[model samples]
Target chain A: MINSISKVINDVGLHARPAAEFVKLASGFQASIKVRNLTSASAWVDAKSIISILMLGVSKDHEVELMADGLDEELAITTLRNLIESNFK
Target chain B: MHYTLVDLLKSEHIMMAVQAADAKAAIELLTAALVESGYAEPEFSVDVWKRELAFPTGLPTQPVAIAIPHADPDHVNNSAVCIGVLATPVEFGQMGTDGSIKLLVNIVFLLAIKEREKQVAMIQQLITLIQSPALLAGLISAKDKNQVLDLIQQTLNEEHK
Candidate 1:
Protein backbone atom coordinates (compact mmCIF):
# COMPACT_ATOMS: atom_id res chain seq x y z
CA MET A 1 0.00 0.00 0.00
CA ILE A 2 1.09 3.55 -0.70
CA ASN A 3 -0.27 6.79 0.76
CA SER A 4 0.35 10.51 0.25
CA ILE A 5 -1.11 13.88 1.23
CA SER A 6 -1.38 16.89 -1.06
CA LYS A 7 -3.07 20.29 -0.95
CA VAL A 8 -5.77 21.30 -3.45
CA ILE A 9 -4.52 24.45 -5.24
CA ASN A 10 -7.22 24.99 -7.81
CA ASP A 11 -9.68 27.89 -7.51
CA VAL A 12 -12.72 25.63 -7.12
CA GLY A 13 -10.95 22.97 -5.12
CA LEU A 14 -12.36 19.47 -5.94
CA HIS A 15 -15.92 20.54 -6.55
CA ALA A 16 -17.26 19.47 -9.91
CA ARG A 17 -15.11 19.27 -13.04
CA PRO A 18 -11.86 18.71 -11.14
CA ALA A 19 -13.46 15.96 -9.07
CA ALA A 20 -14.80 14.35 -12.24
CA GLU A 21 -11.36 14.44 -13.84
CA PHE A 22 -9.80 12.92 -10.75
CA VAL A 23 -12.35 10.11 -10.62
CA LYS A 24 -12.00 9.41 -14.34
CA LEU A 25 -8.26 8.98 -13.92
CA ALA A 26 -8.59 6.92 -10.76
CA SER A 27 -11.06 4.55 -12.42
CA GLY A 28 -8.52 3.62 -15.10
CA PHE A 29 -6.16 2.05 -12.60
CA GLN A 30 -6.65 -1.46 -11.20
CA ALA A 31 -5.60 -0.54 -7.68
CA SER A 32 -8.17 0.31 -5.03
CA ILE A 33 -7.75 3.97 -4.19
CA LYS A 34 -9.28 5.87 -1.28
CA VAL A 35 -9.15 9.55 -0.34
CA ARG A 36 -10.02 11.64 2.67
CA ASN A 37 -10.23 15.41 3.21
CA LEU A 38 -7.44 15.96 5.68
CA THR A 39 -8.38 19.56 6.29
CA SER A 40 -11.91 18.61 7.25
CA ALA A 41 -10.79 15.42 9.00
CA SER A 42 -13.38 13.60 6.96
CA ALA A 43 -13.82 9.85 6.54
CA TRP A 44 -12.14 8.06 3.67
CA VAL A 45 -14.14 7.64 0.46
CA ASP A 46 -13.63 5.74 -2.76
CA ALA A 47 -11.41 7.85 -5.01
CA LYS A 48 -13.09 6.54 -8.12
CA SER A 49 -16.59 7.50 -7.03
CA ILE A 50 -17.49 11.05 -8.14
CA ILE A 51 -20.40 11.24 -5.70
CA SER A 52 -18.26 10.21 -2.73
CA ILE A 53 -15.51 12.70 -3.61
CA LEU A 54 -18.02 15.52 -4.03
CA MET A 55 -19.54 14.59 -0.68
CA LEU A 56 -16.19 15.31 0.94
CA GLY A 57 -16.90 19.02 0.34
CA VAL A 58 -13.22 19.87 -0.11
CA SER A 59 -12.55 23.55 -0.58
CA LYS A 60 -9.53 25.49 -1.87
CA ASP A 61 -6.27 25.07 0.07
CA HIS A 62 -7.62 21.95 1.73
CA GLU A 63 -5.27 19.01 2.22
CA VAL A 64 -6.33 15.51 1.09
CA GLU A 65 -4.79 12.17 1.91
CA LEU A 66 -4.86 9.36 -0.61
CA MET A 67 -4.19 5.64 -0.21
CA ALA A 68 -3.82 2.96 -2.85
CA ASP A 69 -3.50 -0.78 -2.47
CA GLY A 70 -3.04 -3.66 -4.92
CA LEU A 71 -0.68 -4.68 -7.68
CA ASP A 72 -0.38 -1.24 -9.26
CA GLU A 73 -0.52 0.74 -6.01
CA GLU A 74 2.78 2.54 -6.55
CA LEU A 75 1.90 3.78 -10.01
CA ALA A 76 -1.62 4.74 -8.91
CA ILE A 77 -0.32 6.79 -5.98
CA THR A 78 2.29 8.61 -8.07
CA THR A 79 -0.12 9.38 -10.90
CA LEU A 80 -2.86 10.64 -8.56
CA ARG A 81 -0.37 12.70 -6.53
CA ASN A 82 0.90 14.31 -9.73
CA LEU A 83 -2.66 15.07 -10.85
CA ILE A 84 -3.30 16.98 -7.61
CA GLU A 85 0.14 18.69 -7.65
CA SER A 86 -0.56 19.89 -11.18
CA ASN A 87 -3.95 21.17 -9.93
CA PHE A 88 -5.77 18.69 -12.20
CA LYS A 89 -4.42 20.26 -15.34
CA MET B 1 -23.25 28.98 4.65
CA HIS B 2 -26.68 30.18 5.71
CA TYR B 3 -28.40 28.17 2.97
CA THR B 4 -29.38 24.58 3.53
CA LEU B 5 -30.95 22.08 1.15
CA VAL B 6 -34.36 23.13 2.43
CA ASP B 7 -33.56 26.74 1.59
CA LEU B 8 -32.95 25.84 -2.06
CA LEU B 9 -36.02 23.61 -2.36
CA LYS B 10 -39.21 25.56 -3.09
CA SER B 11 -42.64 23.94 -3.36
CA GLU B 12 -43.19 25.39 -6.80
CA HIS B 13 -39.95 23.82 -8.11
CA ILE B 14 -41.02 20.28 -7.32
CA MET B 15 -42.84 18.43 -10.09
CA MET B 16 -44.29 14.96 -9.71
CA ALA B 17 -44.82 12.48 -12.54
CA VAL B 18 -43.12 14.54 -15.24
CA GLN B 19 -43.46 13.28 -18.77
CA ALA B 20 -40.40 13.60 -20.98
CA ALA B 21 -39.08 11.69 -24.00
CA ASP B 22 -35.42 11.45 -22.98
CA ALA B 23 -32.66 12.80 -20.78
CA LYS B 24 -32.34 16.00 -22.80
CA ALA B 25 -36.06 16.61 -22.63
CA ALA B 26 -36.13 15.88 -18.91
CA ILE B 27 -33.35 18.38 -18.24
CA GLU B 28 -34.96 21.06 -20.37
CA LEU B 29 -38.29 20.51 -18.68
CA LEU B 30 -36.73 20.95 -15.24
CA THR B 31 -34.41 23.80 -16.23
CA ALA B 32 -37.44 25.73 -17.33
CA ALA B 33 -38.73 25.62 -13.78
CA LEU B 34 -35.57 27.29 -12.47
CA VAL B 35 -35.61 29.94 -15.20
CA GLU B 36 -39.27 30.72 -14.71
CA SER B 37 -38.70 31.00 -10.97
CA GLY B 38 -35.81 33.48 -11.52
CA TYR B 39 -33.23 31.11 -10.10
CA ALA B 40 -31.43 30.63 -13.41
CA GLU B 41 -31.07 32.20 -16.83
CA PRO B 42 -32.65 30.80 -19.98
CA GLU B 43 -29.21 29.75 -21.21
CA PHE B 44 -29.05 27.41 -18.24
CA SER B 45 -30.92 24.70 -20.13
CA VAL B 46 -28.38 24.66 -22.93
CA ASP B 47 -25.43 24.73 -20.54
CA VAL B 48 -26.84 22.01 -18.31
CA TRP B 49 -27.66 19.76 -21.27
CA LYS B 50 -24.09 20.16 -22.53
CA ARG B 51 -22.68 19.34 -19.11
CA GLU B 52 -24.96 16.29 -18.84
CA LEU B 53 -23.71 15.07 -22.22
CA ALA B 54 -20.17 15.41 -20.94
CA PHE B 55 -20.12 14.10 -17.34
CA PRO B 56 -23.56 12.43 -17.06
CA THR B 57 -25.27 12.40 -13.65
CA GLY B 58 -27.22 9.14 -13.52
CA LEU B 59 -26.78 7.17 -10.32
CA PRO B 60 -27.69 3.50 -10.14
CA THR B 61 -29.44 3.84 -6.82
CA GLN B 62 -31.68 0.90 -5.96
CA PRO B 63 -35.48 1.05 -6.20
CA VAL B 64 -35.21 4.35 -8.11
CA ALA B 65 -32.36 5.60 -10.27
CA ILE B 66 -31.72 9.37 -10.34
CA ALA B 67 -29.73 12.05 -12.07
CA ILE B 68 -28.38 15.25 -10.54
CA PRO B 69 -27.63 17.66 -13.37
CA HIS B 70 -26.04 21.10 -13.13
CA ALA B 71 -24.14 23.65 -15.17
CA ASP B 72 -21.45 26.25 -14.50
CA PRO B 73 -22.27 28.78 -11.79
CA ASP B 74 -22.22 31.66 -14.27
CA HIS B 75 -25.71 30.89 -15.60
CA VAL B 76 -27.34 30.82 -12.20
CA ASN B 77 -28.92 33.84 -10.49
CA ASN B 78 -29.88 31.99 -7.33
CA SER B 79 -28.85 28.67 -5.88
CA ALA B 80 -31.86 26.43 -6.14
CA VAL B 81 -33.05 22.91 -6.93
CA CYS B 82 -35.63 21.71 -9.45
CA ILE B 83 -37.06 18.25 -8.95
CA GLY B 84 -38.68 16.11 -11.62
CA VAL B 85 -40.17 12.75 -10.80
CA LEU B 86 -40.45 11.11 -14.17
CA ALA B 87 -43.77 9.50 -15.03
CA THR B 88 -41.76 7.02 -17.11
CA PRO B 89 -38.06 6.30 -16.92
CA VAL B 90 -35.65 7.91 -19.40
CA GLU B 91 -32.19 6.71 -20.32
CA PHE B 92 -29.28 8.80 -18.98
CA GLY B 93 -25.57 8.17 -19.27
CA GLN B 94 -24.31 6.89 -15.96
CA MET B 95 -21.92 9.12 -14.06
CA GLY B 96 -18.19 8.10 -13.83
CA THR B 97 -18.60 6.02 -16.96
CA ASP B 98 -18.01 6.35 -20.66
CA GLY B 99 -21.06 7.73 -22.50
CA SER B 100 -21.96 4.20 -23.55
CA ILE B 101 -22.95 3.20 -20.01
CA LYS B 102 -26.56 4.15 -19.29
CA LEU B 103 -29.25 3.91 -16.64
CA LEU B 104 -32.99 4.32 -16.73
CA VAL B 105 -33.39 7.36 -14.53
CA ASN B 106 -36.71 7.77 -12.74
CA ILE B 107 -36.03 11.17 -11.15
CA VAL B 108 -33.95 14.24 -11.86
CA PHE B 109 -32.56 16.93 -9.59
CA LEU B 110 -31.54 19.94 -11.62
CA LEU B 111 -29.18 22.06 -9.52
CA ALA B 112 -28.50 25.74 -10.15
CA ILE B 113 -25.67 26.90 -7.94
CA LYS B 114 -24.73 30.58 -8.01
CA GLU B 115 -21.23 30.10 -6.58
CA ARG B 116 -18.67 27.50 -7.58
CA GLU B 117 -17.35 27.09 -4.04
CA LYS B 118 -20.79 26.22 -2.72
CA GLN B 119 -21.28 23.38 -5.21
CA VAL B 120 -19.39 20.88 -3.13
CA ALA B 121 -21.28 21.58 0.09
CA MET B 122 -24.65 21.66 -1.64
CA ILE B 123 -23.94 18.43 -3.50
CA GLN B 124 -22.72 16.90 -0.26
CA GLN B 125 -26.04 17.62 1.34
CA LEU B 126 -27.78 16.33 -1.75
CA ILE B 127 -25.86 13.07 -1.66
CA THR B 128 -26.75 12.74 1.98
CA LEU B 129 -30.38 13.12 1.06
CA ILE B 130 -30.22 10.64 -1.83
CA GLN B 131 -28.21 7.98 -0.04
CA SER B 132 -31.06 7.12 2.24
CA PRO B 133 -33.41 4.66 0.54
CA ALA B 134 -36.18 5.54 2.95
CA LEU B 135 -36.00 9.23 2.09
CA LEU B 136 -35.76 8.53 -1.61
CA ALA B 137 -38.76 6.25 -1.31
CA GLY B 138 -40.61 9.00 0.50
CA LEU B 139 -39.72 11.43 -2.26
CA ILE B 140 -41.00 9.15 -5.00
CA SER B 141 -44.15 8.13 -3.18
CA ALA B 142 -44.89 11.68 -2.09
CA LYS B 143 -48.37 12.62 -3.42
CA ASP B 144 -48.07 16.39 -3.50
CA LYS B 145 -45.47 19.16 -3.66
CA ASN B 146 -45.95 19.92 0.01
CA GLN B 147 -45.32 16.28 0.89
CA VAL B 148 -42.14 16.32 -1.15
CA LEU B 149 -41.07 19.54 0.55
CA ASP B 150 -41.77 18.08 3.94
CA LEU B 151 -39.70 14.96 3.23
CA ILE B 152 -36.68 16.94 2.05
CA GLN B 153 -36.99 19.35 4.94
CA GLN B 154 -37.15 16.49 7.41
CA THR B 155 -34.09 14.78 5.94
CA LEU B 156 -32.00 17.95 5.73
CA ASN B 157 -32.81 18.75 9.32
CA GLU B 158 -31.18 15.49 10.38
CA GLU B 159 -28.21 16.17 8.04
CA HIS B 160 -26.63 18.86 10.24
CA LYS B 161 -25.75 16.20 12.79
Candidate 2:
Protein backbone atom coordinates (compact mmCIF):
# COMPACT_ATOMS: atom_id res chain seq x y z
CA MET A 1 0.00 0.00 0.00
CA ILE A 2 1.11 3.53 -0.77
CA ASN A 3 0.78 6.12 2.01
CA SER A 4 1.80 9.75 1.87
CA ILE A 5 2.00 12.95 3.90
CA SER A 6 2.85 16.54 3.01
CA LYS A 7 4.48 19.37 4.97
CA VAL A 8 6.35 22.63 4.39
CA ILE A 9 9.89 23.10 5.72
CA ASN A 10 9.50 26.01 8.13
CA ASP A 11 12.85 25.97 9.95
CA VAL A 12 14.72 27.18 6.86
CA GLY A 13 16.07 24.70 4.30
CA LEU A 14 17.06 21.10 4.99
CA HIS A 15 20.80 21.52 5.57
CA ALA A 16 23.29 18.96 6.88
CA ARG A 17 22.23 18.32 10.47
CA PRO A 18 18.49 18.23 9.80
CA ALA A 19 19.00 16.18 6.68
CA ALA A 20 21.07 13.77 8.77
CA GLU A 21 18.34 13.70 11.42
CA PHE A 22 15.63 13.13 8.83
CA VAL A 23 17.58 10.27 7.35
CA LYS A 24 18.13 8.77 10.78
CA LEU A 25 14.40 8.86 11.47
CA ALA A 26 13.48 7.40 8.12
CA SER A 27 16.05 4.63 8.45
CA GLY A 28 14.22 3.37 11.54
CA PHE A 29 11.18 2.29 9.54
CA GLN A 30 10.72 -0.98 7.68
CA ALA A 31 9.07 0.80 4.78
CA SER A 32 10.76 2.40 1.83
CA ILE A 33 10.26 6.13 2.26
CA LYS A 34 10.71 8.72 -0.47
CA VAL A 35 10.40 12.48 -0.24
CA ARG A 36 9.75 15.01 -2.96
CA ASN A 37 8.85 18.61 -3.50
CA LEU A 38 5.12 18.96 -4.13
CA THR A 39 5.59 21.91 -6.45
CA SER A 40 8.00 20.05 -8.73
CA ALA A 41 7.82 16.50 -10.01
CA SER A 42 11.60 16.37 -10.38
CA ALA A 43 12.22 16.67 -6.65
CA TRP A 44 11.69 13.06 -5.54
CA VAL A 45 14.42 11.35 -3.49
CA ASP A 46 15.15 8.52 -1.07
CA ALA A 47 14.11 9.86 2.34
CA LYS A 48 16.55 7.61 4.20
CA SER A 49 19.64 9.04 2.53
CA ILE A 50 21.12 12.22 3.95
CA ILE A 51 23.08 13.05 0.80
CA SER A 52 20.06 12.51 -1.41
CA ILE A 53 17.88 14.75 0.74
CA LEU A 54 20.58 17.43 0.85
CA MET A 55 20.74 17.41 -2.91
CA LEU A 56 17.04 18.34 -3.17
CA GLY A 57 17.79 22.03 -2.52
CA VAL A 58 14.66 22.55 -0.47
CA SER A 59 14.25 26.09 0.87
CA LYS A 60 12.03 27.56 3.55
CA ASP A 61 8.26 27.31 3.01
CA HIS A 62 8.85 24.70 0.34
CA GLU A 63 6.15 22.03 0.49
CA VAL A 64 7.27 18.41 0.26
CA GLU A 65 5.52 15.09 -0.19
CA LEU A 66 6.55 12.05 1.81
CA MET A 67 5.56 8.70 0.34
CA ALA A 68 6.22 5.25 1.64
CA ASP A 69 5.29 1.67 0.80
CA GLY A 70 5.81 -1.45 2.84
CA LEU A 71 4.67 -3.10 6.06
CA ASP A 72 4.63 0.07 8.13
CA GLU A 73 3.62 2.65 5.53
CA GLU A 74 1.18 4.48 7.79
CA LEU A 75 3.58 4.84 10.64
CA ALA A 76 6.32 5.95 8.29
CA ILE A 77 4.13 8.60 6.72
CA THR A 78 2.88 9.88 10.07
CA THR A 79 6.37 10.05 11.56
CA LEU A 80 7.79 11.74 8.49
CA ARG A 81 5.02 14.30 8.40
CA ASN A 82 5.50 15.00 12.08
CA LEU A 83 9.19 15.50 11.54
CA ILE A 84 8.54 17.85 8.66
CA GLU A 85 5.90 19.72 10.66
CA SER A 86 8.26 20.15 13.55
CA ASN A 87 10.93 21.19 11.08
CA PHE A 88 12.91 18.11 12.03
CA LYS A 89 12.92 18.98 15.70
CA MET B 1 41.88 6.20 -4.22
CA HIS B 2 42.77 9.75 -3.25
CA TYR B 3 42.94 12.22 -6.13
CA THR B 4 43.46 15.93 -6.37
CA LEU B 5 40.53 17.96 -7.62
CA VAL B 6 42.44 18.74 -10.80
CA ASP B 7 43.43 15.11 -11.20
CA LEU B 8 39.76 14.27 -10.92
CA LEU B 9 38.87 16.68 -13.74
CA LYS B 10 39.70 15.51 -17.24
CA SER B 11 39.83 17.65 -20.33
CA GLU B 12 36.80 15.92 -21.81
CA HIS B 13 34.95 16.72 -18.60
CA ILE B 14 35.63 20.43 -18.75
CA MET B 15 32.88 22.60 -20.16
CA MET B 16 33.59 26.28 -20.65
CA ALA B 17 30.77 28.76 -20.74
CA VAL B 18 28.28 26.25 -19.41
CA GLN B 19 24.79 27.46 -20.30
CA ALA B 20 23.81 27.61 -16.66
CA ALA B 21 21.32 30.44 -16.52
CA ASP B 22 19.87 29.21 -13.22
CA ALA B 23 20.42 26.77 -10.38
CA LYS B 24 18.90 23.87 -12.29
CA ALA B 25 20.96 24.64 -15.34
CA ALA B 26 24.09 24.83 -13.24
CA ILE B 27 23.36 21.41 -11.81
CA GLU B 28 22.72 20.00 -15.27
CA LEU B 29 25.99 21.37 -16.54
CA LEU B 30 27.90 20.00 -13.57
CA THR B 31 26.26 16.60 -13.87
CA ALA B 32 26.93 16.48 -17.59
CA ALA B 33 30.57 17.16 -16.86
CA LEU B 34 30.63 14.17 -14.51
CA VAL B 35 29.13 11.91 -17.19
CA GLU B 36 31.51 13.11 -19.86
CA SER B 37 34.39 12.35 -17.47
CA GLY B 38 33.23 8.72 -17.12
CA TYR B 39 32.38 9.25 -13.47
CA ALA B 40 28.68 8.60 -14.09
CA GLU B 41 26.08 7.82 -16.71
CA PRO B 42 23.97 10.38 -18.57
CA GLU B 43 20.95 9.55 -16.47
CA PHE B 44 22.94 10.23 -13.32
CA SER B 45 22.59 14.01 -13.74
CA VAL B 46 18.80 13.96 -13.81
CA ASP B 47 18.60 11.52 -10.95
CA VAL B 48 20.86 13.61 -8.73
CA TRP B 49 19.12 16.80 -9.83
CA LYS B 50 15.79 15.35 -8.75
CA ARG B 51 17.30 14.55 -5.36
CA GLU B 52 18.81 18.03 -5.13
CA LEU B 53 15.39 19.60 -5.47
CA ALA B 54 14.27 17.96 -2.23
CA PHE B 55 17.41 18.83 -0.24
CA PRO B 56 19.45 21.88 -1.14
CA THR B 57 23.28 22.20 -0.69
CA GLY B 58 23.90 25.93 -0.66
CA LEU B 59 26.49 26.83 1.98
CA PRO B 60 26.66 30.23 3.60
CA THR B 61 30.30 31.36 3.70
CA GLN B 62 31.84 33.64 6.24
CA PRO B 63 33.19 36.01 3.57
CA VAL B 64 31.24 35.08 0.45
CA ALA B 65 28.69 32.61 -0.85
CA ILE B 66 29.41 29.04 -1.99
CA ALA B 67 27.50 25.85 -2.80
CA ILE B 68 28.43 22.19 -2.56
CA PRO B 69 26.92 19.90 -5.18
CA HIS B 70 26.39 16.49 -3.67
CA ALA B 71 24.17 13.46 -4.27
CA ASP B 72 23.76 9.92 -3.05
CA PRO B 73 26.95 7.99 -3.70
CA ASP B 74 24.96 5.25 -5.38
CA HIS B 75 23.87 7.76 -7.97
CA VAL B 76 27.45 8.07 -9.14
CA ASN B 77 29.40 5.39 -10.96
CA ASN B 78 32.90 6.64 -10.11
CA SER B 79 34.59 9.06 -7.76
CA ALA B 80 35.34 12.56 -8.98
CA VAL B 81 34.65 16.27 -8.59
CA CYS B 82 32.97 18.64 -11.03
CA ILE B 83 32.90 22.39 -10.61
CA GLY B 84 30.95 25.17 -12.26
CA VAL B 85 31.51 28.88 -11.78
CA LEU B 86 28.37 30.79 -12.56
CA ALA B 87 29.09 33.97 -14.43
CA THR B 88 26.12 35.31 -12.58
CA PRO B 89 25.36 34.28 -9.02
CA VAL B 90 22.53 31.95 -8.03
CA GLU B 91 20.86 31.21 -4.69
CA PHE B 92 21.92 28.01 -2.83
CA GLY B 93 20.41 26.58 0.38
CA GLN B 94 23.12 27.00 3.06
CA MET B 95 25.59 24.87 5.06
CA GLY B 96 26.34 23.17 8.40
CA THR B 97 24.16 24.03 11.42
CA ASP B 98 22.76 27.26 10.04
CA GLY B 99 20.80 27.52 6.79
CA SER B 100 21.26 31.19 6.00
CA ILE B 101 22.36 31.72 2.40
CA LYS B 102 22.47 34.30 -0.35
CA LEU B 103 23.70 34.47 -3.95
CA LEU B 104 26.70 32.21 -4.57
CA VAL B 105 29.13 32.27 -7.48
CA ASN B 106 31.16 29.09 -7.02
CA ILE B 107 29.92 25.50 -6.89
CA VAL B 108 32.00 22.46 -5.90
CA PHE B 109 30.45 19.29 -7.23
CA LEU B 110 31.09 16.00 -5.47
CA LEU B 111 30.61 12.54 -7.00
CA ALA B 112 31.60 10.26 -4.16
CA ILE B 113 32.57 6.63 -4.22
CA LYS B 114 29.72 4.25 -3.46
CA GLU B 115 31.22 3.13 -0.17
CA ARG B 116 31.65 5.70 2.58
CA GLU B 117 34.79 4.02 3.89
CA LYS B 118 36.50 4.56 0.57
CA GLN B 119 35.98 8.31 0.59
CA VAL B 120 36.55 9.31 4.19
CA ALA B 121 39.79 11.17 3.65
CA MET B 122 38.61 12.89 0.50
CA ILE B 123 35.39 13.97 2.14
CA GLN B 124 37.27 15.30 5.16
CA GLN B 125 39.68 17.17 2.94
CA LEU B 126 36.87 18.71 0.95
CA ILE B 127 35.02 19.75 4.08
CA THR B 128 38.16 21.36 5.45
CA LEU B 129 38.66 23.13 2.16
CA ILE B 130 35.10 24.41 2.29
CA GLN B 131 35.69 26.00 5.68
CA SER B 132 38.88 27.75 4.61
CA PRO B 133 38.38 31.35 3.44
CA ALA B 134 41.83 31.79 1.91
CA LEU B 135 41.50 28.70 -0.23
CA LEU B 136 37.93 29.56 -1.15
CA ALA B 137 38.90 33.03 -2.32
CA GLY B 138 41.89 31.68 -4.21
CA LEU B 139 39.62 29.24 -5.99
CA ILE B 140 37.03 31.89 -6.77
CA SER B 141 39.69 34.20 -8.22
CA ALA B 142 41.33 31.43 -10.26
CA LYS B 143 41.32 32.61 -13.87
CA ASP B 144 41.31 29.27 -15.65
CA LYS B 145 41.02 25.53 -15.19
CA ASN B 146 44.74 25.13 -14.51
CA GLN B 147 44.65 27.81 -11.89
CA VAL B 148 41.66 26.27 -10.24
CA LEU B 149 43.33 22.90 -10.16
CA ASP B 150 46.48 24.40 -8.76
CA LEU B 151 44.56 26.10 -6.02
CA ILE B 152 42.91 22.84 -5.03
CA GLN B 153 46.24 21.02 -5.06
CA GLN B 154 47.85 23.68 -2.94
CA THR B 155 45.07 23.47 -0.42
CA LEU B 156 45.21 19.68 -0.36
CA ASN B 157 48.96 19.72 0.11
CA GLU B 158 48.66 22.07 3.04
CA GLU B 159 45.93 19.92 4.52
CA HIS B 160 47.96 16.71 4.25
CA LYS B 161 51.09 18.17 5.78
Q: Count the backbone clashes (under 3 Å) in each candidate.
A: 0, 13
DockQ of candidate model 2: 0.05
User: lDDT by residue for model 2 over A39-75, one digit each (tens)?
Assistant: 5554456777655565566667777778788999998
CAPRI tier of model 2: incorrect
Regions more than 4 Å wrong, model 2? A1-89, B1-19, B95-103
Evaluate all candidate structures by whole-model CA lDDT and list the values in order.
Answer: 0.83, 0.65
Q: What TM value does the first chain of each candidate achieve?
A: 0.97, 0.85
Q: Output the lDDT of residue A87, model 2.
A: 69
The Cα error of candidate 2 at residue B57, in Å, is 0.4
| CAPRI tier for the interface of model 1 | incorrect
Per-residue alpha-carbon lDDT of model 2 for B50-102, expressed as tens digits? 65565556666645666665666656777776766566677665532222444
Question: Residue B96: error of model 1 in Å?
Answer: 0.5
